[model samples]
Target: MTNVLVCIKRVPETSGQILLSQDGQSIDARHVGYTLSAHDECAVEQAIQIARSTDGEATVLTVGNDDSLEQIRNALAVGCTAAVLVEADTENFGPADVAAAIADAVRSRETDATTYDLILVGNDAADTGDFQVGVRLAYALGRPVLTGIGTVEVQDGTVVARGKGPEGTEVFELSLPAVIAVQEGGVEPRYPSIPGRMKAKRTPVDMVTASVSPVGNGRAALRLPPSQPSVVEVLGEGPAAATAVVDLLYKLGVAT
Candidate 1:
């Protein structure tokens, strides 16, 4: 059985206009809603799919504040066996701190006899596009790592991963106890059912304190480029525009 650990992040959903903080240091989430990162949702789904086939169990882990419990419960509602929360001030932590915290959590789990055969994480967090967690965790654990993975499965004790390459699909094979950074567009994440949600609500999350001090890479501020407005063109009018319409269609390859 392949026991898997999937890491997720609680991020502000970009369903509406994005608002930045006055200093451009972060997203202005005062009016926005929070949810699991899209890529991490796919990672959770893939972990469940793999574990279900082998009668194994999948655990979801997150490093955030108390509010992150909602995201952890959401993963449990889908199919994860349990959840772990590394309680911390998520806003104050940078990518390096997050990675250190996760690494510490993994080590703690190992001491408790909860060994994971595979580790899965989103290619990058949704809120901040810091893509270093998986790689850093792999290094901390002294395991092989792969990123931008679109598909993953186990066969004969080997983990096979696939993703889009410059020419076509690229594949990689690794032994058990490996790390993978899962990308979006890998699979459709299943929604939580009524019964599943009920069960998840009852599940107790294991909350732990960080064993390491959070360190930053000296980040200054974030800036976004101004958006370009759309332009509309009027192509003549009425019957007089018939010739223009035909020409437009021809130019668009709708007709020869």
Candidate 2:
């Protein structure tokens, strides 16, 4: 049977409101309450789908503190059979560090002859919109990786996946044991049933202290919110009235 591994992260709630630090470099997670990103939830669900259809074991892993354990338990509640945590003290770690930590855990499992046929992750963590960990992890593991997958399925000995970029959709058929990064809307994640939740609470999460490298290359500072538009100025009242609006848009380089 194939063993599938899914990677997930607990991130802030979905919002366009970017809380900046005093410096202009990164976000402020000070007041943020981490939750499972919607996109990643889909990734987890997709892994479950693959496992159910292919008759394999699906496991979810995350890197962070005990809060990450909470997130992994939720994934288990949905469908995953087990959870792994590379416990970190804080969320300040970068993708390189997270990747390294995860690589360590993966290598350890492999050393024990624990088998895994595939590994999966989200295209990007929603909170930071940083699409790096999955790719980096794949590179570290020296495995082929596919990113931005929209649809996925396993047929025979190969896994088929579809992805869309600026150009269009691209289909890929990958051999087993590949890494895949999935996007949202691919599959609706299921909520945990009461029995699943109970079982998840009982399942022991394999926790390992992460040897994550420190991050602070350049300190970031926060800034205040930009001024909001005070009032609306009516422009085009009708199609005939849009001539001037179109002219203004042309001047602003939005229209030719």
Candidate 3:
């Protein structure tokens, strides 16, 4: 049975307005909610599907502080059999630092004979938008890596990954023990059922200390794009508006 590992990240929920800190160094999440990246949600689902079909176990992992355990439990509620938490504050760490820590954890687990046959990661982080972790981790582990994959299936000791291209769907075949960076293809993530949630709440998560120190590059502060201005015009009032609407439609060639 193939063992699968899926990496998850806790980022500020992107469904609402995003606010930056005054220093512009990071996202101001004081009033915002937190959730896993959309692509990572697909990754988790993919891993679970693969493992379930093969009678294997699925492990969900994250590089963050104790608060990130919420995400781990969520993964468990869906289908992950277990979880690993690389305890640290990801707020101040960059992609390289996070990748190094994850690689360390993978090595540690392998040393204990908990080898993973497949690793899944999000194509990019929700908040930082960094896409280096999966590639870097694959490099560190000396494994084949694929990024921006939409669909994935394991068959006869090989993985078939598919992604959309400008022309059509592109497919790649790779052997076992490969790292794949997942994107939101056509796969829909599943929600936790009542029994699943209860089981997840009682599952124990393995927590470990950070093995790598965060190092700084020549990078500066983060910034957000300027908001677009909205324009509104008064057409008319009551029956008078019908004439204005008809004239506008005729001018736009929507009417003969």
TM-score of 3: 0.90
Best prediction by TM-score? 3
lDDT at position 81, candidate 1: 89
Top model by lDDT, which number? Answer: 3
Candidate with better TM-score, 1 vs 3: 3
All candidates: TM-score: 0.88, 0.81, 0.90
- lDDT digits (tens) for residues 1-256 of candidate 2: 6678999988866454557656565566667656787778888999898888888888899987876777988999988998888787553576777778888889888889876778889889876667888888889898889988978888776889998867777889988778888998767789899999999898888987766676632334446677787897777677887888888899899986
Best-to-worst order by lDDT is 3, 1, 2
The per-residue C-alpha lDDT of model 3 at residue 136 equals: 88
lDDT of 1 at 220: 89
Q: Over the stretch 1-256, how does candidate 1's per-residue lDDT look in tens digits?
A: 9899999999988897788899877788778788888899999999999999887889999998888998999999999988999988776688888888998998988899888889999999887888999999999889999999999998767999998889899999999889999998878999999999999999889999887776864668867787777676788888998999899999999998
C-alpha lDDT score of every prediction, in listed order: 0.90, 0.81, 0.90
Give the Å shift of residue 48 in candidate 1: 0.6
**Residue-level lDDT tens digits of model 3 in 141-225:** 8999999999999998899999988889999999999999999974899999999999999889999876787874335887777
Task: Pull out the clashing pairs in model 3.
Answer: none
Query: Ten residues in a row with the worst lDDT in model 1?
Result: 210-219
